[model samples]
Target: MRTQVAIIGSGPSGLLLGQLLATVGIETILLDRVSPEYILGRIRAGVLEDGAVRLLDQAGAGARLHAEGLIHDGFSLAFSGQDHRIDLHGLTGGKRVTVYGQTEVTRDLMAGRAQSGALSIYEAEAVTLHDFDRDAPYVTYQKDGQTHRIDCDFIAGCDGFHGVSRKSVPETALRTFEKIYPFGWLGLLAEVAPVSPELIYAHHPRGFALCSMRSMTRSRYYIQCSVDETVDAWSDERFWDELRRRLPAHHAEALRTAPSFEKSIAPLRSFVTEPMRFGRLFLVGDAAHIVPPTGAKGLNLAASDVHYLFEGLREQYRDGSGAGLEAYSAKALARIWKAERFSWWMTSVLHRFPTMGDFDQRMQEAELAYLAQSQAASTALAENYVGLPF
Candidate 1:
């Protein structure tokens, strides 16, 4: 097989890139190690920054999102047994966020690619990249007991953190930075109406709790848990009872309890690999960096990486210039570091640490109190939440 680009994953990042590239007459072949059904079944964060929403639109996958996605102009912060609203629209000059599941976004992008007649190979085994530093780069994979090779001008390493893409790069050429939090988030998906019209982030003596939803009737909630905790230990009744204790009185009273259809625990971490590029192989999304979900920047950061990469490839093919391709790493990292800082800051102020001393707990209280009272502090939060510009 021969193509202009070979994408090493069929996730949202790869599919979105293929959709955008196809619109400009660039041919791409996508390869993934998992089935499509498995990809769509994975649950993930739903919050969409303005920049990500626009990129989906550009990829021709925004129709359903605009139709059914919930729009939120503000969210509440709970501390001191009260709720304080951060007016994102008012503070960010009318910018807002959309609540649309990441699975739905992937489905839409897949449909768009199907309509355009793009090629994607699933269940590809042992995928490998060759000669990425030379003028010709090719990808090889095994399928159906046969070997297949794709010769392409460029390779996109959108295969995520544990995938083969990043591991393919030599350690000497990569510099990594990471921080793993001591706690994890115990999340639940329930078939009940949300407790509030918008998301509420709570800071309580017990821990941090969040009330969020996928739609008007499908709610998703989370509470900070020990890193060593298991989902099997949390029963439905116990989960609801613990959640209620962390919320304010009014919200606790309004909360509706139901059996959760899905339950899981995710550890928080901030990781980044410098440069994001190795010769003609460009790392996009989780392959290059990861952020804690506190600020809801995971998917949005991936979309921004796609935007930077697509522009570089487009410029290279259109004007026969390598300037955009050459600048891809520095540009993507500049925006990525800012998001890393925001997610880290939000996590610090909202969650209780097991090792925190009296002084540390008091500092967290002082920071939240200042944020609640100062308009400038609130605006900064709103601006970062709605997302920094692309």
Candidate 2:
């Protein structure tokens, strides 16, 4: 097989890139180690920044999103037994976020790709990249006991953190920075009306709790837990009881309890790999960096990375120029670090640490108090929440 670009992983990032590239007459082949059904089944963050929304529109997959996605102008911060709203749209000069599930986004991208007659190979085994450092790069994978190779001008590593693309880089050339939080988020998805019109981030003596929704009737909630905790230990009743205790009185009163259809615990971490590019191979999304979900920057960050990579590739193909491609790593990282900082800051302020001392707890309270009172502080929070520009 031969193509202009060979994309590893058929997730949103990969599919979005392929769609954008195809619009410009660039041919791409997508390879995935898992089935398409499995990819669509994975649950992930839903918040979309304005930049992400525009990118989806550009990729021709924004129709359903615009139709069904809930627009959030603000979110509440619950602390000191009260809820304080952060006017995201007001503070960010009328910018707002869209609440649309990542699963739905992937589904839309898959459909778009199908309509465009793009080639996607799922259930590919032993996928590998070769000769990325040379003028030509190729990808190899196995299926049905036969090996197949795709020769392409470039390779896109849209695979996630555990993917082979990043690991393919020599350790000596890669510089990594990571911080693993001591706690994890125990999330539950229930088919019940949300407790609030918008999402709420609650800070209580017990821990941090979040009330979020995928739609008017499908709610997603999370409570902070020990890193060592298991989902099996948290029953629906216990989860509901614990969540209620963390919420303010009014919200707690309005909360509706139901059996969760999906329950899981996800650990928090901030990870970034330097120089997202290695010769002809460029890392995008989780392959290059990861942020804690506190600021809801995970998917947004991935979209931004896709934007940068797509722009670079488009410039290279259109004008026969390499400047955009050459600067891809530096430009993407500049925006990435800002998001990491915001996610880290939000996580530190909202979550309770087991090792936090009395002084630390007091400081956390003081920070929240200041944010609640100061318009400048609130604006900063709102700006980050709506997302920084791509």
Candidate 3:
């Protein structure tokens, strides 16, 4: 088989890239180690920046999103037993975020891909990249007791951190950076209305808590916990009680509980691999970078990465230019670092550190107070939260 691009994953990044390429007549074949059902089953964050939403629209996947997604003008920061709302719309000059699930975005992209008659092989086994560093690049995989080979002009490593794409790169060729937080988020998803109309980020002596939702009827809640914590230790009642304790009085009073259908503890970490391109292969989304969820930047960052790579591919295929591809890594990393800083800063401000001394605690309080009271500080937070321009 031959294609212009061989995408190594069927996640949103790969699907979005393929959809965008198809808009201009470029052909691609997607390979994934998991089934499509498994892909959609994974729960993830869905806060969409204007730029991300625009990219989805550009890919022709915005119909369901715009029709069903919730729009939030502002969100509250809970501390000192009170709610402080950051006016995202006013601060960012009418920009707002849409509450759409990542799974839905992937589904829309998958539908668009299928409708375009592109190729996607789910449950492909033993996928491997070969000669990506040379002029000729190809991929091999086993399926149904048979071997198949795909020769492509380029390879896209959207398979995520654990996938073979990044691991295929020689260690000496890549520079890595990482920081693992001391805590994790114990999240619960239930079929009930959210405690509040808008998302809330709560800072309390106990830990950090986030109140988010997939829709008006499905609420997602999380509270900070030790890194070693497990889902087995938390029952529905205990999780609800712990969540309530982290919120302010009014929000706690307004909170409603139901039997949770999903529960898990995810560790927080910030990781990045420098120079997202390796010759003919490029890493996208979690394959290149990861951010703690405090700033709600994971999916948005992935969208931005997809945009950069799509532009480069488009330039190469349509404009007969190599400049965009050459500049892709530097451009993507520049925005990536800014987002990393924002996510790191938000995590620092909103989370309780296990090693926080008395002085550190007071400083965190001062920072939150300043962020809530000062217009300048609030503007900065709102701007970053709504996302920076592409």
TM-score of each: 0.99, 0.99, 0.99
Clashing pairs in 1: none
Candidate 3: residue 164 lDDT (0-100):
91
State the RMSD for candidate 3.
0.7
Q: Where is model 1 more than 4 Å wrong at Cα?
A: none
Q: Give the per-residue lDDT of model 1 (tens digit) for 82-152.
A: 99999999999999999999999999999999899999999999899999988999999999999999999
Each model's RMSD to truth, in Å?
0.6, 0.6, 0.7
Q: Give candidate 3's error at residue 389 in angstroms.
A: 0.8
* lDDT (C-alpha, whole model) for all candidates: 0.95, 0.95, 0.94
Question: Residue 313 in candidate 2 has what lDDT?
Answer: 92
Query: Judged by lDDT against the true structure, how good is candidate 3?
Result: 0.94
Model 2 TM-score (2 dp): 0.99
